[model samples]
Target chain A: MAAKKRKKSTAAENEIINLTNVCKAYSTGAPALKDVNLRINRGEFVFIVGDSGSGKSTLIKLLLRELTITSGYINVMGYDLSKIKHRKIPKFRRNLGVVFQDFRLLKDRNVYENVAFAQRIIQKSNKEIKRNVPSILSVVGLAGKYKAKPRQLSGGEQQRVALARALVNQPTVLLADEPTGNLDPKNSWEIMKLLEQINENGTTVIVVTHNREIVNAMQKRVVTLKKGVIISDEEKGGYIDED
Target chain B: MRISSFFYTLKQGFRNLFRNKWFTLASIATISACLFLFGLFYAIVTNFAHIVKTAQEGVAVSVFFDDGLEESRMQEIGELILKRPEVSDVRFVSAEEAWESFKAEYLGDYADGFTENPLADSAHYEVYLNDVSMQSALVTYLESLDGVRMVNRSEIVATTLTGVNALIAYVSVGIIIILFAVSVFLISNTVMIGISVRKEEINIMKYIGATDFFVRSPFVIEGILIGLIGASIPLGVIYGMYNVVMDYVTTRFTMLSTLLSFLTVDEVFRVLIPVSLGIGVGIGFLGSVATVRRHLRV
Candidate 1:
């Protein structure tokens, strides 16, 4: 008989997320994720590695409450995602930072205002904005580019600004969806390193990527999805299967 | 949610209003022209009503007694007409006094050639009416009396005035409705254009957790500003036009001066300024709703 896998208890260190048999289906028949489960301990740097259309992006969207799971349980920051009210979505979002592949920065605003916008939504004090914005910009290597427009900056610089905005709120978890998808190889590595630095400071980092080079290089706990099923989840993983 | 945040929307609206200056001015011009026509029609209707009242006051019905009636019968008929509550006052004019007054006025031209006074020896009871509408009823009752030969009133003039009044009212109300519709359309469209142009910015505000009220308040306030500016132009024009019209009517139509007291400048201003503000505020509210509904999808 197969050994019974006991559910890991998260009540010890206050787990940030716990998912069990999470399944999502867009249509009546086909499933996006089939009988999948995930557990993320607090302050963990985890990478969701999969090929294109392997449901890695779907997992991030479900975690962020941007999309709903068809059937199964998802708990994020100790709140049930399925039971979250519509009005409470903003409050929930304020607690988590989401980075888009497309870099969803407001084109009309400058670098300073773009980062300041995140703090504005959370209703932070002027003194806090005055204090945190410069520090966050400096961390993202954009210290002196406060007045620069998004279009005026390089693609890499623009992504840094996006990261800075995500970091300014000091969220519980930072979800970066293909954070380096548009960057050059050098810029991509630089951004991954920045994410590593952010994770060291006590924020749970979830990076979704198909980049084999960066995935293998980071050597963090890798959860690999193959055809909507987690075929391999290891303590430490590599880019190619070591079969 | 806070007062400071509401100010932010207002500032955004004003900024947009200035940015889209041509569209704003076009809407204001449309609103001013419509309001001006409304004010002009209002002033005309008011003056027309004054004319009607003057005409009604001047045209009195005279109840004439028969020549052969006794003085006691004539006096009894006079007393009967006077007893009706609708009758304001009754004055008895004897036939001798009537002829004497006629001779004094027209004798120089033709009275010397007449052998005897052609005027009948009849009692003329000049009846004042408290209600103008009761003139026909009073005439019918007087004609049925024992000594009254005829109750002559200006029926032609009354009928004509009634027709003119109906025409004035129909035209005034029609014009007012048309102007109101056009003005409201202009205001709503102005706001619609404004919302469409800033739709992206508005969407970001929604995504970033701005409340519906915070996103909406600025457009409403902007509508109000547009309304106020639009209304001011017509208000000044209306006030100035009233003065010019008043002077013209008083100087030329001298007969009207004694019977009809024209509206004072202050009275015109009092009624018009409120109407202007009301239009401004009402349209502003409607325009704001139009804008917010279109742009602030959240």
Candidate 2:
């Protein structure tokens, strides 16, 4: 069964996500992540910056519970990552939202249906889905394009549809990995602005990206990685390419 | 899971059943044909067994008396046979009575066409045994009797029929097993195609926290529909065709009907219905579950 929807959890001031000395090593290669320690409290906007192979994707994967850590502890929303049952991983994932670079929308489904799918997975009633889908679409500026298929929409609109899908559940933490990678500069700024608004509304947001200009402009707390280890963590830090 | 979720998966499965028209049709066609052949073989094998069983039931030995024996002597012989431990029933039929029964049963109006009763040496003790396996020993004892001229028994016919029945059953089972395996493989491949068609959607679903059961339900539902439709076609066809053939054989081919009786379609489907439906649905579920499990390991 799906887990219960989470409460705000802000009153207790609990850390929403925690990773301590985490390590992930594949059999054929060196460690993808080494001794990574990080923590984020409620309603903070953070960015994870790294070059290719610097383990940004690996960190995102670890937080999503898609990859088992080789060692050390990771916890999110009071559930230990190592102790969570395999069948309950999906229930754990519902506490957070996820977005991707390519905007993974079901091509056969329209914008509204795409966003509503997340609710349907948790077995929401038709009445509830009806009430929630339109409101979420309005949040992502897709209220009038509910019937448009993925191929029929522009790239940014498709990403918006994906964002709507991710946010429809009102997740406590929003994890966006290269969300604006496929968009032009103007579209990228709009997506960043939306993420900023979402963070302001008492939700923790974590963005992983390679876009240096957008990172410098946002001046968010940035955790930079090099050679499978954290080199710097700072509040209001800009993306320094040379590390 | 909620009731609404159950309905959603069911409706999803129904809609997906028609998603790829050609693939669904092909799978159903193959399944129906396989099931039809299975039903046909079942009829033939069961009828063969029925005929063998009846022939075994009717097995008996006849003890005939000498031509010069007095009626009193024949009566003593009949009494002796009646006293035997193996004999279940012993009834004496005289030459005249035996001839009359023969003419009435085998000759019909053709007996009137004949002026004389042609069967002269038909008198005997029609002895039924408690067990067919004791027939040989009884025949030996009767042959050694004083007034007995001959012993007539259908042991050879019964033995041959029983053996043939066993052979038919073995061969039919072997064929059915091979055909069933092939049918299941074809069903698995069909579901595999459906999974491949929606790989991207499936990946997205998994990432968004759709459980394995939810992700797999639609395909399973489609599999069940295919199985249901596939089995019903052959069941209907075989039942109707069996009745037609049974009517023709029982009416027009009287001689063959006596020796080789076929099962009524109703009788055959008593076994066929469960077997066919089980095969259809079992394969469908197995295929879908296996494909989904392997494809969406996350």
- TM-score per candidate, chains pooled: 0.69, 0.81
The DockQ leader among the candidates is 2
Q: What are the runs in model 2 whose C-alpha is more than 4 Å off?
A: A1-13, B20-23, B50-59, B63-99, B102-151, B236-259, B295-297
Candidate 1: count the clashes: 0
lDDT of 1 by residue, B34-136 (tens): 7777777777677777667666666677888776878888888878988997788888887777787888897866677877657765558888776566777
Give the worst 10-residue stretch by lDDT in candidate 2 chain A: A1-10
Per-residue lDDT of A74 in model 2: 93
Model 2 DockQ (Cα-based):
0.58
Query: Which whole-number lDDT from 0 to 100 does residue A105 have in model 2?
Result: 88
Model 1 chain B scores worst on lDDT over the 10 consecutive residues at B1-10
- Clashes per model (N, Cα, C within 3 A): 0, 0
Candidates' C-alpha lDDT: 0.78, 0.85
